[model samples]
Target chain A: MEKRVTVLAGDGIGKEVTDAAVVVLEAVAKKYGHMFRFDHQLVGGAAVDAKNNPLPEETVASCEASDAILLGAVGGPKWDHNPPALRAEQGLLRLRKQFDLFANLRPVKAVSTLIQSSPLKEDIAKDVDMMIVRELTGGVYFGTPSLYNDEEAVDTMPYSRPEIERIVDKAFEIAMKRNKRITSVDKANVLATSRLWRQIVDEKKAQYPEVEVRHQLVDSVAMSIITSPKDFDVILTENMFGDILSDEASVITGSLGLLPSASIRSDGFGMYEPVHGTAPEIAGQNIANPAAAILSAAMMLTYSFDMLEEAQAIEDAVYGTFEDGYFTGDLTKDQPLGTKEWTEKVLQRLQA
Target chain B: MEKRVTVLAGDGIGKEVTDAAVVVLEAVAKKYGHMFRFDHQLVGGAAVDAKNNPLPEETVASCEASDAILLGAVGGPKWDHNPPALRAEQGLLRLRKQFDLFANLRPVKAVSTLIQSSPLKEDIAKDVDMMIVRELTGGVYFGTPSLYNDEEAVDTMPYSRPEIERIVDKAFEIAMKRNKRITSVDKANVLATSRLWRQIVDEKKAQYPEVEVRHQLVDSVAMSIITSPKDFDVILTENMFGDILSDEASVITGSLGLLPSASIRSDGFGMYEPVHGTAPEIAGQNIANPAAAILSAAMMLTYSFDMLEEAQAIEDAVYGTFEDGYFTGDLTKDQPLGTKEWTEKVLQRLQA
Candidate 1:
């Protein structure tokens, strides 16, 4: 099998981590006997410096022609004074809009080796492995008539049946692949959009009869996430609730630097990236952790390319490196491995 | 000094806890030499059973005539099947609407004696004594044109200058009384209402120059609540964000049975209640924990009556009872105190 991938190594540490992930991807391809073509494109601060546009036409064209896109990180203080349209984050947002990437999958699994670093008690954080499926493009964030003046301000939260249906369907599909349990979260009793959201989930439940489903209020789920995170499988929520919850879930493991995320459409076309951002201070230092970026490549392999076994192999190799007592600067104060050295450790395991 | 207090011992263990709180209030009044008048009113399922209305007209009248109101807990499974308007929770909502209780205050403090029960590590939960002030009557929860049909649903989040001003002022005033620091939370970068909310907080900051203020995005604040809860003094947010965050903050202490909340107007008139709900299974049993209800009375003394010293006295006594290794069934497994026994312990400390 052959697949063309777009690599948008945006800026700063983005290049270093993406390079590390590409090395891992190349190793995976060699071992699995697959042809993988890489197309590098400019985006974010780097694109703004070169083309004066954070998202250039050529970059979009390359991504549109690819099977999957893997982004490193975007933004730096140097471009902080730029207008909204010229900003680094706007590039990623526009790409999502362009591809209609409506579902954001953030899977937070507490690594056994890092359990002691978790804010939650070891007993509570030990077995917390859940996927948070966030509806990325709809709801309050993009709802129309978001206007404000000196006297008043208003933002709308609008959800149509089609929008809710697509995301709920994605959650159900993901649930079917994993634990077959879905916790649909909303404020159904208050907001009309949430009521519609809940209704759509109920309708979708009938189509996937084998998957167990339960509805929870946003507030109740917030408490439950901390009190009993092991109880959840796939947490499906609208844009704003998902935004807050996904971020909240990110911190429990205390391994923010090693979490990966994917924003994909229904057709499995996705842009994968590390949950961490550009570390401008550590740019080109060869010291930033590349585990998240490597894991993101693993996600793209599974979600976009349907190479589940290869993805599992890459994941096991990454975790095995940590289990073998290797450390990154972010994860430890003791002898830490450089970006290149850490990727070497993972590669050695994969090759062996 | 003289004050009239209205007590709404709603249902289930509500009567027992409120009765326990009333006993503490009586003891405080006797020690402080204050003339206190107590008036009992019916609400929730109790009101529904007696008057066929969850919030009876007479109950509202009594609350209006009182200087402050203390609610135990409301709603039980017996009323779970009732119509929407007749539900037990509606009574509490109507009461808030009737009194224009726009600011909901929930304070979470990790007690030294109970620190071991926190879900977070001891160091992270040790100094978590933050107050969350939520805007209750505005935002998406009660916004206009909240309509949904087969195709689409929409809910407006509108905030007027006056609405934001009052809540911000309340938060600032509370900050002045506490640690003199406030963290105003909003999603200013994306939502128009949040931008306006931030503007109002900034505008009000000049009026209270002694108070230190900072603006935080709602998502970031959610993560911070768990990662570094001790960093916050007062968290001010809109209705929905508050609902989710306040609940999230509640579980970190792992002492849900001992948290208190308040819904107040700008003029200081307020209704106090425990953060815990009506536990129908524990109803008519003398083993229910009354710590939260007792704490609500403490909040009433400080906020409604301006009896700060008297409030501190009650607080110290309650903590002292716990420090002495006494606890209700909810907090212990070894020879737990009954409701009356716990109240007696608190009373003993108050008298001492």
Candidate 2:
């Protein structure tokens, strides 16, 4: 099998991490007897500096020609003063819009080695492994007539049946691959959009009869996320609720630097990235954790290339490195490994 | 001093808990040398059973004539089959609408003795004494043209300057009373209403120069509530965000039975109630916890009547009772006190 991947090493620590992911992916390709071609593209702050555009046309063309895209991180304080269109983060947003990447998958799994660092008690955070499927493109953030003046402001939350159906279908498909349970979250009693969201979930469930479904109010789910996170399998929510909840779920793992996310469309085309952002202060230090970036490559393998075993191998190797007491600067104060050294350890474990 | 208190012991354990609160209020009245008159009224399922209305006209009249209202939990499975207007919870919603109770106050404090019961680790859960002031009457919950059909649904989130100003002022006032710091939560970068909300907070800061203020995104605040709850003093947000966050904050303490809430207008006229709902299964039993109802009365003393010292006395006594190992069934399983017995213990501590 062969795959062409676009590598967007945006700026700062993004360069370090994406370089690390490419090395890991090369090792995986060698071991699995697959042809993996990498196309490097400048984006975000780097693109803005060199080409005066946050998302350059050549970069988009390379991404359009690739099977999957792996991004490290985007934006920095240097570009913070730029106008909205020129902002570094706008590059990633535009890419998502261009690809119609409507479903965002954020998987929060409490690593046993990092459980003590979690804010939640060990007993509560120990077995929390859930996937949050968020509809990325629709809802309040993009709803029209969202205008404001000195006296008043109004933002709309709009959801059509087709939009709700596609996301719900994605959640159901993800649920079938995991624990076969989906918790559809919304404020059905109050918001018409939520009611429509719930209705779509109910209609879609008939198609996936083997997968169990439960409807929960957003508020109730928020409480349960902390108290009984183990009860959820796949949490499906609209844009705004998903934005809040996915972020909330990320913290329970304690190691933000170890989390990976994917934004994909129906055809399994995806852009994978680490949940952490660009660490400008630690950019060239060779000290930033690359676990999340490597795992994001793993997600790309599974979701975009349909290489489940290769994905699992990468995931296990990453976790095994932590289990073997290899620490990154973000996760420990004692004897931390450099980005290159940590990827080396993961590679040794992957080959072992 | 003289005061008229309207008590609505709506349904289930609402009757028992409200009865316990009355005993505590009577004791406080005697000790403080205040003339207190109590007017009892029906408002929820009980109102539906007796008067064929969830909120009877007479109940409204009684509430209007009173200086402040103390309500028990409302709603029960028995009324779940009723039409929307006839539902038991509608009574409470109508009351808030009737009084224009724009501000909903939910205070979350980690009690020392019960800290072990929290889902959060002891260090994270300890010192979590924050007040959440929510704008109740506006935002998406009650926005106009919240229409849904087979194809699409739309809900608006609208906030006028005056609406934001009043809620921000209330939050500032509450901040001045407590820690003199406020964390205003919004999604200003995306939502137009949130941008206006942030603007209002900035404008209102001039009037509250002594109170320190910080702006936070709603998603960041949600994570912070669990990661570093002690960092917040007053968390002010719009209706839907507040609903999700207050509920999230509630679970960290692990003692939902002890939490109290208040909905108030600008003039300090308010309705106080326990955050817990009507536990119909436990109704007419002596096992219900009345700590929340008793605390609601304390909130009434401070907010509605401006009896700060008297409010402190009630608060201290309740905590003192718990510290002395007098456990209610909700807080403990071994040798738990009955509803009446717990109230007696609180009363004994108050008198001491």
Candidate 3:
């Protein structure tokens, strides 16, 4: 199998982490007897510096032609002074719009070695392993009539049947592949969008009869996420709720820097990236952790390329690195390793 | 000073808990040399049964004529089959709108003795004592054009300058009285209403120069509530964000049954209630905890009546009840006492 991945090493630690991911992907390709190609494209702050635009037309074209996209991180204080339209983060939002990436998958697992690092009690936080599937394209963030007239402001949170259907179907499909329970979260007791969402989910339940489904109010889900995180297998929500909940879930794990996320359209195309932001402070330090970016590549292998064995191998190597007493500064209870050293340890485990 | 409080013991454990609150309030009045009057009224399912209305006109009139309102839990399974207009919870919503209660205060404190009750580790959850001030009347929930046309549904989250100013001022005023910091939560990066919200908060900051203000996106606050709850002093947010966050804050304490909340209008008129809902399953069991209801009375004394010493006395006695090896059925790590027995213990501590 051959895959072309557009690598957008945007700014700061973005370049360092993307480089680490590429190295890990090369090892996976060699070990699994596969052909892989990489296209380096400028985006975010790097693009603004080179092309005077956060997202160049050429970069978007390259990503469009690639089988998958791997983004490291984007934006920093240097670009913070820029106008909102020209800000580096706007480029990523535009990219999502270009691809119409409607579904965002964030898998938050409490890492065994770092369980003690979690803010939640060990008994409450330890067994949490769930996938949060969020509807990205439609919702309050992009809905019509969203503006302020100096005195008052209005933003619409709207959802159509088709939008709800596609996201709900994705959640069910993913739930069937893993655990059989899907928790559909919304404010059905109040919001019309949530009522429509619940209606569509109910209609789709007929098809996946074997899968168990439960509907939770958004407020209740927020509370439950902290109290009974172990009860969740797959959490399906709209854009804003997901934005809040996925981040909440990450914080509870106490391993925010090591989490990866994937945003994909209806088709198999996806752009994977670490959940962390560009750390301008650590850009050239060579001490940034690369595990999240590497794990994101693993997600791409499983989700986009259907290379389950290769994905599992990479995941095993990541778990092995931590178990073998290797740690990045962020995850260390003892000795800390640099990006290159951590990548080397993961690579050795992958080959074994 | 003399005060009249309209007491609406709505449904299920409402009667049991409100009865306990009255006993506690009476004890406080006698000890503190104040005259207190209680006016009983029917509401929720009980009102529905007797008057064919969830919130009878008589109930509203009684609340309007009183200096303040103290309500127990509302709604139960008995009213589950009722039409939307006749639902038990509507009574509470109608009352809030009737009084134009715009500011909601939910104080979530991690009880030191019940530190083990929280889902978060003792180190993270031990010192959490934050007040969440929510804008209740305005936002997406009640904003105009909140409807569905089968294909698409929309709810507008609109905020006027006055709404923002009032809530921000309330938060700052409360912050000045407690800790000197306020964290205003919004989605300014994404939502237009939030941008306006930030603008108003900034304008109001000049008046309360003594209070340090910080801005955080709602998503970040959700995560931080779980990761670093002890860092928060006051959290100010709009309706929907507050609805979600207050519940999330409640769960982290693992004492949802023991938390009290207050919804206040501009002119010092307010309604105090337990954060817990009526448990129909345990309605007549006498096993429900009365701590939250008793604490709600404490809030009424401090917030509406301005009887600080009386409020402190009630608060201390409640805490003393917990500290002196008396445990209610719900909060018991060892011995469990019934509601009546727990109320007697609290009363005994109050008189001591």
DockQ of 2: 0.92
DockQ metric for all predictions: 0.95, 0.92, 0.86
- DockQ, candidate 3, comes to 0.86
Best by lDDT: 1
Docking class of 3: high
* CAPRI class of candidate 1: high
* Model 1 agreement with the true structure over A14-118: per-residue lDDT tens digits: 999999999999999999999899999999999999999999999999999999999999999989899988999888999999999999999998888898999
Model 3 lDDT per residue over B1-352, tens place: 8899999999999999999999999998898888889999999999999998989999899998899999998898888889987989889988998899999999998777888888888888887899999999999988879888668888888899999888888898789878989999999988999999999999899999999999999999998999889999999999999999998999887777889999997788999999988988888788999999999999999889888888988989898887787887777757799999999999998999
**What level of docking quality does candidate 2 show?**
high
For model 2, give the RMSD to the true fold: 0.9
Q: Candidate 2: where are CA atoms >4 Å away? A: none
What TM-scores do the predictions have?
0.99, 0.99, 0.98
Candidate 3: stretches off by over 4 Å: none
Report the lDDT tens digits of candidate 2 across residue range A1-352.
9999999999889999999999999999999999999999999999999999999999999999999999999999999999988899999999999999999999998888888998988998987899999999999999988999999999999999889888888899889878999999999989999988988898888999999999999999999999999898999999999999998898886876799999999989999999999999999889999999999999899878989899999999998998889988889898999999999999999898
Top-DockQ structure, candidate number: 1
Candidate 3 residue pairs that clash: none
